[model samples]
Target: MKVHLLIQRTFAGLNTEYTSNPAIAQLDNKLFLTDERSVVMQITENPVFSFAKNEKWTCYSFIKRALDREKRAGFYAVRLFISSAHKLTNVKDCLLTIAQRYEFFIQNNTPSQEYTDLLTQINEKAIIEKERYTFDIESIRKGTYYAIATAENLEALFADERNEFVEKLYLFTTNIDSKLLAEFHLHSIDPLSVVKWQINDEKKALDKLWLENTAIPVFAKKLLSLQGAKLYFQLKGQQEKRELTGTNELKTTALIIDDADKCITSLKINNTAVKPQPYFELYALATDTLYYTLKNGKEIPLPITAKLSTRKLIVENSENALAKLWVNGEELPIPTGKKFEIYALTTDKIEYTIVGQAGKKTTVNSDIKTLSIHLPNRGQTINDNKKSPVIDILLYALLSLLVGGIIGYFYRSNTSEEDISAIEQKIQEKEAKYEQVKKELNSSQILPNNTATKTVTSTTTNTIKSNNTTTKTTNVATKTTNTNSKTTK
Candidate 1:
């Protein structure tokens, strides 16, 4: 429920100055506050109260006069805009409380912030302090609404227009107890004249206890009449009762298991614990939807059953979190301090994969009741086994090269120019002498030159570059001659 508050100050021979917490539109202010009927000119025994509604909003206005020397100077109009379903009685006490406080502020000459503070308090009280049952009202079809409420004497607001209330009958149910008390307020554009009411297909004239408010008999297996209690109606075609019970066992076949050891653990639904049976055939409700709580304190509704009925899969991540786990290309969030559980219905198979596992897909047969998977640990992601070896090898090679470059840099930086020159000269001398010795050995080993020869060549070259220094070495390219006539020397 949302409450929009607007306050307007109107004095004789002066333009109306208005302020609203949520900033109501000028048209709404004119309709609910600045209008002559809403503004009280004189102090009266009873405060002026009125209701106005538009296409999108309904306004409740209360006017209270501030007295100066027992003479009426001006008046303040407090208008509340809310959903059409809420009644003025719901906020009457709060309205009076605010009016009395305003009277105090006027007498004491309080600042403007006090008004803002008062509006904030009232808004908070209406939204947070006052508690109301959360009802799931769904329109099944034209003129037919299916609602689930937790408490008795639950009143829901519906439009009185023919287009909105096209059907003659509406259905309601309560899960807390068999008894369900309901009131339907058929509101129209004009509140004074609401359409007449009737009961059932008989067209019996159901008396309107108040304008736009009517109470009908409670619907049960057996007909029962009570004040403000409307009877539940059966589905158009089905004979079975559509009554949903909180604890009554509808069916028990699904199981929740640990992924690590395939052991069954106790189940917790919405923070309530349920012990498993001996064979772990957990009792499940005959409902299509279930909720999973995320680690970030958010609840996500997931489907328990798929299109097909026979094939059912109960999947849970008991050992690891499912934040990065993907099922059929959909990411499954990890539950906070609980195992992530789901009852999925499938036609053939359920395909799932780890996020970083490089498309390593796993398939579970629809016939199988349980699924085993190694989910990623909390705050961690699954690594791809196929890509890890190459990554490791590259990392090792890079580290070796980096270390060698650093050593070479420091050695060169510490050496003088003279020492470097001396080292280069010594290396050149050693290379020249080695080449001369290699040439003499090659000449001595060659066979006689008169025969036809076949030549074979082998070459080796090595190069290392690091830290602004490059060294290249070429090994001897061996040439062997195989003659037709051997040992002809």
Candidate 2:
């Protein structure tokens, strides 16, 4: 793609600045700055240029207030020209995108960085050799050139007098904007005989002729050559915000950088281990599925492609470690190196517990392709064995005293032979008191247990569409069982 930007300050009615691919259009250096003594041309070349004369043209014009207008109110008129080998279907969008960018440079009073970069590319292309053409009777191709002279006069100029009386020649000069001409006369030795003969005595005519002879035609030809070429434009915030048109579904390249641990045996894509390189520039459609094979040979499909641009994919194994085996509705076991897995299908609900010093538990469902899990060190149990011996002695002494008192009461009741009703009431009261004391003692003790329990529940989300509306149905399966068990000795 090629571009030309021409900006003019309205108050001064002079060209303020221009940024162009020199191949598209070359202008005099005096036109760049606000110099009153400079001989400015009034003609503004059509902003849009087309290769073939009849080609449809699309370009943009903008009138904006000057950034600094303390002395007088003035505006800047900007003209934008774009050309390409492909038809630019999105011309308005491209122009708007460039306008927004150019406006920023104007506001900042700085030159366009994009134009600078384009010039660098142009310079590099200039180094390569290309075919050249000379303007002469023998070198000229079968193409028409402007001429004001009559057929007889043109024939006499190129005629070989020794061989023929007159040479057969042609002249096409009708409605040729002769005064609005350029250096179309330079190719011939006596160009003035054909071009200069008509332009004289009029100051305006001379000026127009000079302007036409400049690089304006080159710019027009550049645009014509790209009549049907297509162009694409992307702004900073466009990617994520733009609707998915599906037009750019073509394959895109992405550079993958694996900053994971070197201990990883392999990182496979499509069941093949990725070769070690500085980075892998994988090419695939944005919607295409690529698989990441787990250690257990389970393949997880991930879409890691981008469109129109090269994206960066960074893989850090320690943070995004894949589990050797992942079972729904079960506690996730962290590998020896404090690594855990946290990724599941978009509709899957995964619940896992990481038993460590803090005993962490969480339930999660991921919408993205990858998820990271960081596990801390496993939990430990502290046993107070020294206090256990003392507790055992106290328990035995209490049990012995309770047994002796019950026997003494039963013996005294039998020996005394008091009222039978009174004796029964006393026995009931004593039994109730003893039960309460035992309950209180049981509630006061705390013991350490080296066991972890996890309840697992698996859930799947399904969308059912009957007609226009979509209904979401969730199915859940629960498993209640102890994951880890240890009996105290």
RMSD of each: 24.7, 28.8
For candidate 2, lDDT tens digit of each residue in 1-489?
344555555444444555554432343322222221221112122221111111122123344444334445444544444331222232333344555666687679785446555334433442222112111122112221222334345333322121111111112223234344342321212222211111111111111111112211111111111112221222121132122133422223353433232222234444434543333344332443565533323555666633111112121235333333334664445455533333333334554443342344444433223333333321111111113435635654564455445544554444222333344455456446645655664454322221100100000001101110211111111111222222321
| Highest-scoring model, lDDT | 1
Compute the lDDT of residue 293 as modeled in candidate 2. 38
The 10-residue segment of model 2 with minimum total lDDT is 452-461
lDDT of 2: 0.32
Number of the top candidate by TM-score?
Answer: 1
Worst 10 residues of 1 by lDDT: 452-461
Candidate 2 residue runs with Cα over 4 Å from true position: 1-256, 262-289, 305-446, 449-489
- How well does candidate 2 match the true structure in TM-score terms? 0.20
Error of 1 at 146 (Å): 33
